[model samples]
Target chain A: MAERVVEARHLSKVYQMGDVEVHALRGLSLDINRGEAMAIMGPSGSGKSTLMNILGCLDRPSAGSYHLDGESVANLDDDQLADIRNRKVGFVFQTFNLLRRTSALENVELPLRYAGVGAGRRQRAIAALEAVGLGERLDHRPNELSGGQQQRVAIARALVNEPAIIMADEPTGNLDSKAGADIMKLLLKLNRQDGKTLIIVTHDSDVAEQTDRIVLIRDGQVEADRKLGRSKKIASKGK
Target chain B: MDFIASLQAAIESITANKLRSALTVLGIVIGVGAVIAMLAIGRGAQDSIAGSIEGIGTNLLFVMRGDSQNQVRNPQPLTMDDAAALSDVFQAPSVINVAPLLQGSATVSARGESTTTTLNGITSEHEAVRGWSVSEGEFINSSHLLGRSAVVLLGTAVADDLFGRHDGLVGETVRINGQPFRVIGILAERGTGGFSNENDTVMVPLTTAQARLLQRSTPRSVDVILVQAVDADAVPQASEQVANILRTRHRTALGADDFTIINQQDFLDTAASITGVLTIFLGGIAAISLLVGGIGIMNIMLVSVIERTREIGLRKALGARKRDILFQFLAESSLLSLIGGILGITLGWLISVGVGAIAAAANADIVPKIGIDSVLLATLFSMAVGLFFGLYPANQAANLQPVEALRYE
Candidate 1:
């Protein structure tokens, strides 16, 4: 029922190596609605990662029409793409690509720095870290923290800028089962309570079952789109 | 990031690689130190020469008879009457004092000890012209001339050689050219004057030497006519007047002139110009070492860029601008050279002080004067070397693409 936040038409990504041309994404079109928690499920080489990159504005589609919040991203330059990534989209990686030598607070403050936020905006960063249950570990660096804490710091960094959408690539792939479940719970809480659009790419069936809807991607095309009945149980527990 | 942060990062990185940084900086240190030390020694030598020339008095002039060709052909000496005629006839306000010198070499014996020395016949005013002072007893004066006393003033070297640790040679008789002459004074040591030893000569009144020692008619044949100008500012005028008067007395026109007037001021100026040129030549050669040091910096920076490729890529991925990366490397290189320059300056100063001490111990007239300009120049040159050599690698780092850099392992 919510308005569509992302619209893609005839999107294709190609790579050229020597004389060989490989198409990573093939003529894909999709729409992502606002306030929706969706999981894009696919096996290896299914082009899910490519789709996620294109959606996050990290890489451009070779030939396609991508409208992110009603703005065409297909014709944008690298800087413009980076600007869109900085201003609109937030990314969380499976490995938690946080700066190794810097503290958690500084990691969350990175996007704010790109946004030209002054030092006075530190309170916003503290709030974001506290939102991810990482307020107590703000001064700890990535190497000093546990796996779950590091992922929480990454999530805090992703949500610090209050972006339009959070695109995660196997956000819990590197964590243990318990940590993975905890991260899933946090993602679900962010989706339902904060009303943020969340698109996660994962191969785990249990993780996919937690989202509001699941879109099965096979060979760079959507195979099935289903809304979950289990969301009702999670929604009851959210209150 | 802010400048302070960037500088702090650069310093931290440099400090982390302590041995590598120290070795790199050592090249610059030696280069700068050599440049400073060489220039200081050269400058000190120049100053010493100029100081010695000044001690001899710039207002003095020497008039010698005949040109080089005639001196080779006839070896005819000048007459004392010629000196008097010029002194009386010139009548210029710039003319202050004139003395004629007749020099000859002979063996002088005293108390069974003998030394070969140069004997010089001169007037009382010769002391003023030659800037000589008596170390002990009286100099030959009007009384000695009026009495035609056979008296001589022994130079320090002559007295030391002939007397052999004896004190107060005054009133003692020393035989000059086989004739006895009482020692009236001992002249202070005047050091060497390039061509010969100045302290090996003995002085006596011209009339007394001619009458008693030389046994020659006219008794006026002289080697040089010494003249002192009334003031330093009047030397040029006095020199020209003496030349003109001598030429008139000799009845010679320009180009056919028989006498040569040597101006001490002109000689000092010429010596200064020559030493300046020598200093630049030596300094230029020494600057080559600095250039080599700069090349060493370039070599090291290139290697550093290659070694830190991953770090550069990571920083670029973190949103560092091209200028940021460039400034980081440039700052590192500059710090290397700056530290080296400081150490080099200190080393050069210590070396100069050590050299000065050695010279002082040996009682040599050489004094090394280290200048402030050399230190400042070395510092600036080292910085310039850093900037110049660091440019290529910095450019390579700055131009790296963020995507390619992030993908770099």
Candidate 2:
């Protein structure tokens, strides 16, 4: 049995929208093991966002238990959740959320700064940027870079802390076809070479085909969990 | 996040919006500058007043007729005899010198230039007791007072009024109330001191004035008796001694004496209290502007927090804790004020120096005083305003939900 990095069972979330109860999630259960690249896909209102938020530690489940990397985090307070997010879950957003007017090197070092990693921050951030093929663009601000380069910087920021899982939400949504392909290639490289578990939320089937498995959600429940390749180790080695 | 990172981030944010940051800092700059300049002017006025008070001879006592407005019996006027008694070493040992003055306003003409000015009948002892020295020729001598000769010493203003100059007036003749008196000396300028213009008086021999210019009902009644104590420490003793001698000489009871004693220190205390109040008043008005500046900071901070909502969401998603966001905003606001405070101090110092320059150009005796205490107070107070006013907006930023913030346009 491969070591499970994420184990969530029967999760549910209800939002109070001004005296109306809106159910965002309902009895959702999923599991992701170490070093696996998985894509979560659903329609706009199918509760995929809520699941991503819960699994990414940006939010807690209103009901049910969740354990990430063997720690029960379903009932963690806000600060404790923040710590878990810092140490375990790295995020890459659709908009390439590199801080404006900041150098790529500094943007990549941001996570290390928040994690209180002192003295060796520059070395680690430089290594991460180099891993994304942006070592020479370290001094360039976000606006000075191409859309693909900006996303690379975002990926570097995500990788600097070596989080257990990199959660990418439409990471290539705003890029051109060429840039999107390049970004996908870089993300897969990181997953395969470093054995980093990757979870992507995307609506593009082509992007989903690149992952080892795909989980489809509907009406706040997992509708299908499909495997497109062999087991985790074989898939990573084959890629 | 650590303090250094927060500070760096704050600097980056402020520099990104240069115009807005400068405008925000302008409010604080004006507030602190106004506060410092007002305090400096107030202190300068206080210092000039103190300087004039000290310029008057120290340890001096003024003996005047008591207040008789509410009294039934009229108070006896001070006389030359009382002055003579106070000068007696055995009777009042603390009394160093006593100079009797009999003064009245008169019209004096010299070289067809006439002006109505104060005429004083003063003995030779008046020079030492009043701290006025002759700038040209000689002062009133004992022989001149004894023989009751018509000799006069011209105060600078009177000399300038009569002859268009202060010096070279020796042996000149000036008429007082239709009587001619020779100008033997010109008195040096003494500026204004303690309710009277010292340079606006003309002096003549006491005997000459008594016999020729003005006469009283009593043989030797005088208007004021000026007594000098040995030193500052001897003023109270000298006052008590002079009061006792006058009570005995006039045969009046204690607490019902016919004379009043005024000391130089009384003027100092009164002037100090008045200027102290003026300083606080000026500073209080300036503090209102400082409060307004603080509100300006709060307003700008609130706007900044709203504008950076998406950035805050991104930070939180990237694993920034609540305090990290809180500290970033707080650091930005206080850094605004801190920079403003430093620049404001420079602005304030420049204003004080400018005021001093203007005063000097106007020939006024004021020098703006900028003390270190005021500088320190303005710096600390402005920073506190920034921090205090920054709390609400920073809290709003820290308490934002990442999902909603990320969704915000």
Candidate 3:
């Protein structure tokens, strides 16, 4: 009975490389409801990243109908897609992707800046950083932060806009086991406490086990979809 | 993103690499500085030349023998009669006064010293016509002209050269080419203004020069005539009126007048045009350096675009539009060039002042003139160069696809 956050039907993508036609995606349909913490598992070249990119509004599906929050995203221009990305979705990357030489506070405030939210930007940015237990590291640049701290800052930036969906691509890939566990726990806390719709693409089975649903991707199509029981505290700190 | 935020990011990026930014701005600085200095020097030269020309007296015209197509040998030169006719206000209404002159070099001896000096034959009104003043004694009066007196006025230079210690030159005898002539006056020293040296000549009456000094078969032929207008604004009208009178009197048709009239203002205009051309030429050369500087900006901006590929990708992924990236880079480039322009203007002003000081020390006539207009123009031009040259790189940054750029590692 929950409102569907993403309604994608029959998406296909073909990339031409000189004389060879490379079919990265066949036809794939997907639907994710509100407050669903989903994990997409795939091997390399399986077109999992491509679907993630499309759903995040970073790219348009080659042949498909995509409705994000009931708005048709297939025909939207770049600016409109950017607006959707800014206001409706947030992204976290394995690399943390924070602007170098910029403070953590500024990094967290970037979305608000793009949304034209000027007043109280500093206070809100501080509060967001504080929410992520990074209050003292607001002035620290990305290079100065630890791997876990950097990922925490990225998560703080993602949560700043209160986006309808949080999309992360290998969010813990660059971290060690312990830092990866911390990041996964933080993501779980966002899903539980903030009620965010979390969608993450990862190859780690242990990381996948913590999600409420697991969607397996192969050859640009969804191979299997399964609903998991409640989180079994896959991240040790979450227990 | 908002403009202020983008600008802040740009400023931070620029400040992060101080040496690179400074090196990048050097081209714009030198380009703009060279332009300012060239303009200042050009304007300064023009003003000084005009100042010296105006020193020769305003609204004054010189009528000299040009070419005579009808007469081949010793074509009738401007005579004292012609000067007298022009002096008649009824005949040439714009012509205020005229002085007929005859000049020749002669050995002037006083006491035991002798020096070769220019001998000018002029009447008393020559003082008023030439804006000259006497320092010691009276100038050549009407009586001296009528009596054909054997007397001379010693210019300060020739007077000093011949009679260094001798005083009372007013009544002293100074021989002109072995002919004894009484020294009547010593002219004031008015440093070289190119209307001949004011303090380096000897003057006698026009009648006496024809009678005893430069004796010729012709009775009243003078070498040149100096005509003064009533006022500054009346000069062009006065020149035309004088030309008309001379044309009618000589029976020469239009464009066939045997005499050439040169107003002081003509010298001013000619000098101005020469300096103006020089300014443009120098500014153009400097602008080439500016052009090169703009290219330098483009080159570095392209490099920056390449280096920030990942940053561009991340911003796009984080919801930055293409125009946002374009505006950010463009704003950074413009800020770079504008800062360079400000520094360059300051440096150019300093260079001009320093050069002016050196010129003053060396006794040069002109001082470098830096105008506010040049500064404002330089600033605007630098920013325009920044914007113009920055377009390609900014476009390159904006056109990157987020997926491709993110994979640029």
Q: In order of the candidates, what TM-score does chain B achieve?
A: 0.90, 0.94, 0.86
Using DockQ as the measure, which candidate wins? 2
Error of 1 at A199 (Å): 6.4
Candidate 2, residues A1-239: lDDT per residue as tens digits?
Answer: 78899999999999999999888899888999999899999999999999999999988889999999999999987778878888898898999988997899999999898899999999999999999999999999999999999999999999999999999999999999999999999998888778899999999989988998999999999999999855555665655
Residue pairs of candidate 3 with colliding backbone atoms:
none
The B-chain TM-score of model 1 reads 0.90
Docking class for model 2 is: medium
- Candidate 1 overall lDDT versus native: 0.79
Give the i-RMS of model 2 in Å.
Answer: 0.9
Off by over 4 Å in 3: A231-239, B68-74, B104-119, B146-184, B191-204, B207-219, B233-237, B240-255
Question: Model 1: per-residue lDDT, tens digit, A1-239?
Answer: 45889999989988797899877788988898887899999888888877887887766889889999878988876556656777788777787877666689977877776566777657888899999998898899999999989999888888987888898879999999999999999998899889889999999989988898898877777788898886666556655
lDDT of 2 by residue, B109-224 (tens): 98899988999999988889888899988988789988999988888988889899998889999999888988999998886634567888899988888888879877678888
Q: Candidate 2 at residue B56, lDDT?
A: 78
Interface alpha-carbon RMSD, every candidate:
3.9, 0.9, 0.9
> What's the C-alpha lDDT at position B187 in model 3?
84
lDDT of 1 by residue, B1-409 (tens): 4565557656876776789888888888888888887788777777777777777765888889787456434423568777776577436557888888777777888888898888888788877877888988887787887787888899888888887643578899998878898888888878663436778888888877677666554455777888888888888888888877776677675456677788876777888898889878877877887788778888888887776776665454334556777888898888888998999888777777777778667655666777888888999999999998889978887776544554455
True-structure RMSD, every candidate: 4.9, 2.1, 3.5
- For model 1, what is the alpha-carbon lDDT of residue B398? 71
Backbone clashes in candidate 2 total: 0
Extract clashing residue pairs from model 1: B78-B222
